[model samples]
Target chain A: MSATESVITTQKRSIWAGGMSPLKVTYGKLMMWFFLLSDAFTFSALLITYGLIRYSYPGYEGNPADFVFAPDKWWPIPEKVFEAVPFLHGVSAPLVFVGIMTFILIMSSVTMVLAVEAGHRMDRAAVEKWMLWTVLGGIAFLSCQAWEWSHFIHGTHEGPMVAEGTTFFGANLLQNQYGPPPFADLFFFITGFHGTHVLSGVILNIIIFYNVVVGLYDKRGHYEMVEKVGLYWHFVDLVWVFVFTFYYLI
Target chain B: MTMASEESKTIQVTPPDKAKIRKIWMTALFLGVVTAVEFVIAFTMGASAFRTSLFVGLTLVKAFYIVSEFMHLKYEMKVLIWSILIPTIFIVWLLLALLIEGEAIFMVKF
Candidate 1:
């Protein structure tokens, strides 16, 4: 043992020596993972901030069944505020629209994973088909968000009075008919941030889809790019699960 | 140039596995069912600590499926899994601290 140790000591070895993929993943994928970790922190900070602000507000102490929407209430019930559905005026459908939106996102995520799976097999035709579906799904989800946002911004038909002679018609940065100003602001910020992610994910998917159609990945002999983008897409879906829980459900 | 070629060589494109595809759809179905359950609870049940906790638990279940199955993190190396999961604990801690502090502020101000 001593002779071998002396021989090994004579030859220098550095732990910092490069040329090894320790995680058994490509450099691009590893970087994406780290970027996602940092992005996770950013989102966590936003959500935790929302939780803190929500906690600071005094919620309704009455029975949930007897609850009604009042302008003076500091913390408005989510179901009451988000009751209206598209094309169904004055309908008391709580969480239904958001549920549809969630379903769309999850379906898109499924299509995305299918695309990645198709990529794994180097099936160009299948990849194109699934990627197209995934892209369409993303566009559909974004369209749903736009409709929801417009609906939220325009607000209900009642246009309840917020103050003396000041009828609140809709929500904005300064004021809203629903709860507090922060509620509207956080809704816009968090959902807007998430919407931006979905938008970017769609654009990225388009680019990758274009590349796939153009036979770029085929020429390159690999489709790891799709897998990387799939990671980001899945992360977006993951974030929505929590947002649905926090903003809509809780 | 050699490194690029060597890397490509190590990356093999295998035929798609039917079992794996079935697993993906099954996970998706699980996510959809959990979400539907959340919707049902949102309507059927009223707001309370228990209801909130139930929703949160179901959300974690959905998150687990998305991360593990969709993201394929479950098949990754152990070190990679730990590296991602460990940092998330601090986020939970932040939530706890700020919630407590927020409640205190409300108690004092209101």
Candidate 2:
């Protein structure tokens, strides 16, 4: 083939056309993607370990009564474990709080996307407003998580004593009212780790919101900062989806 | 996009378009619906391997939706997307190895 023909043949075919970021994404956004990828593995490892240990047990087998913590193991039903809403004391509402928490995270993610879109259009007021909502959502999620932890730690308000057979109630680093002790450990580790991420996301978002207020991005002429922060916020939401599924649902 | 508007040396303030905001709202609605379905399924379904698989599959769908829509991975370069995704094959490997090996260890012990 002629030199020109070879050059033409070897050139990137439509796919790899853009220089570094063929899709035209920003550097910070690309780095955020990498960071999320690494974080995904960390979560996956923890989750897989949870699966291993959980399956090793005999499982609840439907009823917690027939279940035991011995050779034939039984992990407590998550629904039975987390069955409390804020003020509705003594009510048996399983997964209600978690459902609300899921909605909150998703709405925050929406606000985050809108903020990024506003950044794209250089709408400072819109960016700030949407970002503020996003920050509130994060705080709300963190607060919900705190209440959950405390509730778990405090156990039931006025239930039977702990000496009721092999079964335990509530949770801690030690034994949990849940069937298997490891189950509580996994719950604490996975959700606690996720809560820490949510905490960091809140802090990062506040800084970005402050930046938007001070016209920092406005001066820079672009709101890529909002987009970068949005990526992290969305990732936190994404991980929560999996956590919600495996921990609570399954 | 340039930081400063050509007309103004300062930042140009363009208003957020309604159509785009509506689309974002719809995405949020879709995510919420999916989660609601998962919640309903959790209550209705009993513990079985099939139910567990269903939950895993649904979780994956939700995960992908968040990554694509919220994280904007769908709008990213294919190379960049693959660079982020293909490596996840190791997670599959890690899971299989850990689970199988873990089971083997459990069997040996108990």
Candidate 2: TM-score, chain B only:
0.84
DockQ of 2: 0.57
How do the residues A1-250 of candidate 2 rate in per-residue lDDT, one tens digit apiece? 5999999989867755655556577777778888988999999988888878866665555464443333224566778778889999999889999999999999899999988998898888889999999999999999999999989877786443344365455667777665567877898899999999999999999999999887788677789989888888998998899889888887
Query: How would you encode candidate 1's per-residue C-alpha lDDT over A182-218 as one tens digit per residue?
Result: 8899999999999999999999999999999877787
Each candidate's B-chain TM-score, in sequence, is 0.84, 0.84
Model 2 chain A weakest lDDT span, ten residues long: A64-73
- How well does candidate 1 match the true structure in TM-score terms? 0.91
Measured against the true structure, the TM-scores of the candidates, in listed sequence, are 0.91, 0.87
Candidate 2 residue spans exceeding 4 A from truth = A1-23, A62-73, A158-169, B1-10, B105-110
Give the backbone clash total of model 1. 0
Candidate 1: segments with Cα more than 4 A from true spot: A1-16, A163-165, B1-15
